[model samples]
Target: MLHDIGGQAPNPRQTKIAVVGGGSTYTPELIDGFARLRDTLPIGELVLVDPAAERLELVGGLARRIFAKQGHPATVTTTSDLDAGVAGADAVLLQLRVGGQAARQQDETWPLECGCIGQETTGAGGLAKALRTVPVVLDIAERVRRASPDAWIIDFTNPVGIVTRALLQAGHRAIGLCNVAIGFQRKFAALLGVAPGDVHLDHVGLNHLTWERGVRLGGPEGENVLPKLLAEHGDTIAGDLHLPRPLLDRLGTVPSYYLRYFYAHDAVVEEMWTKPSRAAEVAAMEKQLLEMYGDPALDEKPALLAKRGGAFYSEAAVDLAAALLGSGGSPYQVVNTYNNGTLPFLADDAVIEVQAAIGARGATPLPVPQLDPLCAGLVANVTAYEQLALEAALHGGRDRVFKALLAHPLIGQYAYAESLTDQLIAHNQEHLAWA
Candidate 1:
């Protein structure tokens, strides 16, 4: 790793940003994104917090190099101590997990064997992960209050909505981050062969669990783009591409995985054991890409001012950051924010993802017009699950956990729900000792 001592003096009023999981494979891109903002904004210091010393050092070294190369050297510190890392920070970014990816794969596949949707994003997988995470996340939040009392938490963890809601319920300043909130519409625009700028969409519900109620072209035919997209690219968009395509096509519109559970229905799988073939195909493609690229960590270290390829580095994420920073004074698109009774279908205090006007203060959730029956039911189930999980966390009662599992759509029967709940709790013996 290299370091560059920049030629510029530090701005006294700059904000300090702390990325909690700096060792994560995804941090390079995010760090690169923040580095590019140096020219337009005054960021005083950058902190990378991770428990692994080697990984922590690598990221800190990268940040120093990036800053020096840009001729704007900001103080860079790496630490295993989260308290020291978050001290004086303006934002705490989280992307940690109790169980790694392999464990997550087990969480998904095992539930699949039980005839349930196997995804960390929603359903049983989400509920299980949420149960394990609530305590840890709350601990982190309490520290944030003590260290940086006014700091905002930018959560990038799985069970995004659930975890975000838990922190908010505890009265912390936090907002969950989900690419699905905006990535789905971008996918829709690509299928229609139009610039994403030319697409207009309305989305609502929870993270990885939402429905796109409207779609339109910004051009002459501003009518709903759903019927056309469904008629033209329906099969290829939903079928050939593995993702929300099938779910969206079934609803005759797009399904935002922002709240995926809402879109789970009888047609999502064949007899509930198999997902559409597109998911399999996409998985294969992703596997091939990983095999070709291997772990990004193995390559020669990224340059101090290096830029990664693809839209993630170049377009979408950059656009979102710029919009939030008020770069062009362009209106920020709506996104998931705390509902202040704006959405009638969900509880007033529920942290729901909706279209919002973003600014320096961050996202402001907008009111949704209405929710279809399926979407409404999904919001209800997931919201109820979160509430029950909170109750379980507060009281340390496994009964609350059992009730959450019982309320799941696929396991709503009293006997089946209780049996599955007992089995899961039994299996998670080590983690559930407190409850």
Candidate 2:
């Protein structure tokens, strides 16, 4: 990848931002961020777009209350009309779920029946989500493009790499955002007795398939702290990764939690069969969260949002939006952008999540140190599979789905691929128009 080093001052101006999936239980978390970071982002208007009227009412009301409670000046609005919602927006955030938790339940369950990881952003299940989500998201992106040509799309949707790639492929001004990298930076910063701002990670690889090969303190070259973190907090770290400390010590790099679906695939699959799917758990949490949101007195985000996952999501989203919209902050942040020869192995067109300096022109991948063979091998394999998965998601067929499953590292067996293809299609028939 090519690297350009520089800094630019942010032009202070009021912004009108739209949250495409505003009814999501996660919206409050984002609203809370906006309220706290108001001095930085300075929102003029905030719109929540969703087809669910009741959810929009509950979420929009609570969002307004949160801003009011924080004494924020932004006005919050709710709407089902995409064109109206995105009209004149400076930036649009996408976080939609195609079939809700019921569909997610199917994605998480059927994959385990074929002995594959059931997570929503990594393997077969993630592919199912991509297939159902891509078309809807593209349509939304098109509306944003039409309504406001200069609008920047910040995607927080699942299967982020695929969705971001689809948006970019359609010539939309977009960038992908994920919490995994920031979550690690915050954790490492806490352990090192420093502010999260002091830590910068060599977070590399495709979405959900990345690793922190190096952790630099103060600046990109300040000091390497990955060894120190692994040495002192190895057990706690290992528990979070669900991998052995010895493996981390051996590799001398910390992998993202999603890597567990790869390093310990069979174990995860076996263990998953014994528990309720994450979708079921999140669905129940949303039920309680919506109830809490309906309370007029509850102005702050519920504590239960932490259990809803996406920790530090609002901060990352705000940071990215500010940088993308020219409220310049840090010089670098982990983002999903075009590879542009960053890996030297993957196609330039392949979207890889890496550190990049954000500007109004969008992200340019930072120069990366040579990757170890082990990491490169897994990244290359998964990137190829992601290519096929995106193709299948865009143009569906039983054979294409089978092809995607067969290419997955966690489901390489022909028998497993065939069975998963049949079961996945059957389970997702409602969402899969092609099926």
Candidate 3:
């Protein structure tokens, strides 16, 4: 946390933000947010940094055009150098994919061979991603820290908990970012017929493993409308969660979509085998998105970008950055920061995603209700797995990977961990340096 020389008032100074994975198809969405949110986070410059030269050119050019069309005054630049791109920037946003869609394809496939749920950021697959991603992210973070020591590192990477913990352990000023909580905020707001700003959610637990127990109106002290939401929208919400309405009604809480992988492990594994990997789908969409960006007249975010996923991501990033940089807006936003006793059961250093008051000093987790035994137990289980996953990610080995997988509730069986560990290393040999 940096010292606040000025009071809690919003800082009007212009800022420089560098997007580490600027070549991603998602960059335009972020650029669109910056254009619309100029009043919130005034940008002096926005740099796009990526190793892929071709994609960087397309994404950066379209980014400049989008800003120009929106009458935004910020400068947009493209670069392959992480150090130069981050040098003197106020903040850096990380949205990197190490093996591109190919690695993600492997991550989503191999675990299924051993009868485990195959997903990018959980189970055996997420472990593989953590192995491939953590070192790369750490290397890049070192450059960011050197280039701009005071810059805030906002990570939007997959397997966010493991990657973020790695960053924080290394003593970087980092806070993980995800769009899941914001998705719920937007949904509840739309249902309540109130502006999203008026809604505050009790988003507890870790990334991907979270629950919305209470949805309050106005501020944190406002009336909790969670019961009304469940009673009136149970069926719709159940459909979204893929859980039986009885289960949601029984627990009196709405779990995140990723919970489906756990709550219905065998069912999801059987279904995942038949469907193409999400990476394959996103790759196809990225092709079309790049084509659309090449259009000289195209400036606004294309409809196909929605198909690429990450709906309302730019808005969340804008709000979070504005809050973190002390630009303005409400005092609280849901973010991935250290627990610091937010969950009494979890370690103080454990990273949890919950409502946090953001400012120049950093985020402090807001007060949350006592966790139900069910949610607390699951949260504790996953947090242990994440810690082991980070260990395996940092110091690579087949045994370490196996231990991490065994720690996961979904792959607790010794047989599954052994076979999945072998398959993970085999599938991701290129991405895993030790392999």
Candidate 4:
């Protein structure tokens, strides 16, 4: 059993929260998350921040409706001012992605020309995004430090593991959250025709780049069913899904992310084309959804979530947050927290995801005893490059940035490392403002 730090649920009371980037499509889910916990974590006030007034109002309005409908008396405020949003809050959530989806697509695609996978969440794409995001995220961290000195930051940004590592190294209290692993686990269980709870998993490593070491179904009684289920039921579930699972099934190990690169290894370009075509597929799916229906924007309105009246926050997002706040109950989650040697397979200082127990003391990442060699090597390599990039971001220099780019396994030891480095830098030079 996992430990629960929150001794008991706090009584209903006002709690101030600052949600940065309120205009994001994710705001409604966040607001709903708070509503579900209102009985224990009463909302005193909510501060919403965004640049566009109209977008801010839309999300802010939705937040209000959720709160009112839940019978919570929390006051909601919208602002374009950054400092005002950070002031007097118990917690702050950072959810901004600098260049949006189009920019991300470019970041991933350009790296494909070189025969490497171009995903902004990991590898060289992760480094490039870190260069662009560290400054912005840190700026928000600074505001939280000054305005709400004791507040804990919940980061929902991409490259979450790397970003969370940077913040903690800089002496800020923060936790980065992602649900990719959980999403995949559920998909796998459904493929095997088992209840999600009936499936047990061992997950480790960074966001968008972890591996499931073991899987068991049916608990002690169901232990005998796993092999047969793997042999027969696997096809049904694998066939229904349109993701990396099929590859994972063939390898006899769950595929967390490496599968994307497996199928499109030769399409990698330079830095600008780093995102894999798999992302393009997801975009294409979204576009097809829009076209299939009469609407052009499928996600413009609310989405049909997994649970009803569960929370506004994404199911994965809420699971992490509520676990930290002591209101959630999930078997396990691999979240980004300060690496205090949780994953022995990697460096102690390398931030990673292992099992975690969230309660009164906040998220407590558990230790991982062992890991698959492939996953360990990949995470270590990525973390090495990522740490160098963080250093470059902190102390602006071409040398540090180049060193980081060259250190990457995909880009390292290649004759074109210098030229590729130069071209990549030139393409994403806007990121140089920070480095």
Candidate 5:
């Protein structure tokens, strides 16, 4: 069904892909992937769509040069108009930040004042991002539907679980993606002395809240080398997560680094208060990246971009897009999609991140072994918060914001929820129309 676009199958070599936030410092990283993995996705045209004219031109120019340098024949173009850019495209990638890093700096800093972890995709800060992002993303999806009805929207936006749910609820064709799974897969492979493709993760839970229950070699049914990985590389893996080695040994599972927020809330809050907000560091990094993009001779992604994070982003994007468009990609990948009984405990419409078969019909989550009560309870708690968050994002009101914040496990107390609600409104009033 995914291949049947307007009753005609899409030509694999004529794929057109659009990056909504084309001007972002992250664009080059994505472009680098398109160039390096051209055989995987086979993009005929790449469009960079953004409202920021200056940054769009700079990123667009670098993108073309990168393709040229790689000897890939894809035509790279830039445009400020959204509809024009996505028209007839086979896939559209959403990476826009509604309020940019200045707003992200506010999202990361304000919540710490309430004794909660300040993060762009979790806690009160995440709620702020979801509220601003969901509406804009829905509007863009609507336009994409009108312009290219069969175009698949590959959302790499933060608060992915929430945004993808919004698109699906509105009846749009979409899939949510993140680099965390691929990043872990690569790290585990290196530790086991194997290829990244040879590694398969029994990765489950909501986006940003997943745990790797099993790390299989060769395929999903292949030997689960997770326990071996923990035994051999416990200290190294635990160090990366910033969690205690004993915790991993006891649980016998690998939690994503984001879990540190929930697993060690107060300690993380204390550390966040001491360090510069991640958003601030990224904003400074973006300034430098933009200046580097102005360089005409730089045809490849800079080593400095590695420090910008989103590790393995391009590979993940290309894989998801290729699979969804009926091109040859990995048979299985970790993606965010409808729960649809994947976790029977949650509503069928709830969006969840898990390992699934990726193909033209979109993601089909592999059967999960029974989840531990410890992780299941946390996943359920966050799912409830996400549902409330979506309600508030779709229909804004101060009360709705307060309800979502209060529902979050990190801010269950009414007093803290009230404070965060007021702070979030004050900081993001410009973007929230109801405010």
Candidate 6:
């Protein structure tokens, strides 16, 4: 049985929601959703929690203005106190970055030194992020558990699979969320010239590493039009993924762009060598965004925030929160939840991202057709790396870190793993208690 937090159901008209990293530039996007979709999840109170008091104040001010402009009745408040912010929240969203973009810059750059893709959420860099992030998230989750025992924890942190597994292993009432699925739903909907809600994706695999095997119209049982999408708009999709159209044609499924780091590792490494790390770009963007937020006249999410990434984040968060709170939302949405035999090859306790029926009880993955060996092989490999990553995150030791890095498909060479492990520890020593 799923663990029950045991409380009276939340009053839909008076729901209290807390965002742990609420001072984020991403908060405006989320606030935009709460204001626009108020009827779906009527929040009586919304709390923005962050240790950065200055950013909290700026973001909180904007949040209130946005809500007022939208004529939403919800009260918006800001706090640096985690416990106080989450005290009575019906749902708490996690989007904190443990070491900020500086650490991320390190995560991105150091892996490239060893000729590997240096992304914040994949390869050796991802293991580094997992190490820095998992412990912090678990600590925050524990605080929420104590302050709001019935509060549902929605994790949007990077390296989501590893962090989420740590949460479940510790018995926190948590579910992982990402924007990839919803992004696809919107993209495909536009291509099909239908309402976004009318499109349902047969999205399956682990977080970040997923593929859309089928695109159903009207509903899950609706006719699959994936082939139609490929035939007509294959070039657009391939260009977006930075991969060739023939590859998608050969696979007959749409792989997440993250796959490029794996499918074209050396190519991506070469590309990274020429471009600034994504962290640098985001850091610069954030500076500009915070300045924009301080403008009293700016009451909406900036167009620049769109380029800051996390596309469709607000909608996905609102939908997942509503469904988990027993409020109204789409019956089928994609989320990261316990495998529970969803994929036969993975451990039941493993976390996988797939289209699921989300309700107050939590996410139940829909039955997935057998995965083609091409995708399954990679998924299984990454799942193993994720398992090892969680173990290292939960405990702290150089050996564990090295093993996780070695297990990752993107950095399988023992020499690279060993070098990356040392660099990871050197860069993240302050965050890792045992480093």
Q: Which candidate leads the pack in lDDT?
A: 5
Q: Write the per-residue lDDT of candidate 2 for residues 278-344, one digit (tens) a residue.
A: 9999999999999999999998999999999989999998998888887755668899999999999
Give per-residue CA lDDT, model 4, range 115-204, as digits (tens).
Answer: 555676655566667777888899889988998887888888777877888888888878887766666567667766777767656666
Model 1 ranges with Cα > 4 A deviation: 1-10, 37-42, 62-73, 191-200, 216-224, 240-250, 257-330, 360-362
TM-scores of all models?
A: 0.78, 0.96, 0.96, 0.78, 0.97, 0.97
Native-vs-model 6 lDDT?
A: 0.89
1-435: candidate 6 lDDT, tens digit per residue = 111111234345588998999888899999999999998988888888999888888888888888878888777777888888899889999998989989999989988889988989999888889998998999999999999999899999988888888998899999999999999999999988999999999999999999999999988899999999999999999999999999999999999999998889898999999998899999999999999999999988889999999998999999989888887888898988999998999899999999899988888999998998988999999999999898898888999999998988888999998899899999999998997
Model 3 / residue 146 / CA error / Å: 0.7
Compare candidates 2 and 6 on lDDT and give the better one.
Answer: 6
The collision pairs in model 5 are none
- Measure candidate 2: CA RMSD: 5.8
Q: What local lDDT does model 3 show for residue 114?
A: 86
Q: Which regions of candidate 4 fall more than 4 Å away from where they truly are?
A: 1-12, 36-44, 68-73, 188-200, 216-229, 236-250, 262-264, 267-301, 304-313, 327-332
lDDT of 3 by residue, 104-186 (tens): 88888888888888888999889989999999999999999889999999999988888999999999999899999889999
Clashing pairs in 3: none
> Pairs clashing in candidate 6?
none
Model 5, position 90, has a per-residue lDDT of: 93
lDDT ranking, high to low: 5, 6, 3, 2, 4, 1
CA-lDDT, candidates in order: 0.63, 0.88, 0.88, 0.64, 0.92, 0.89
Worst 10 residues of 2 by lDDT: 1-10
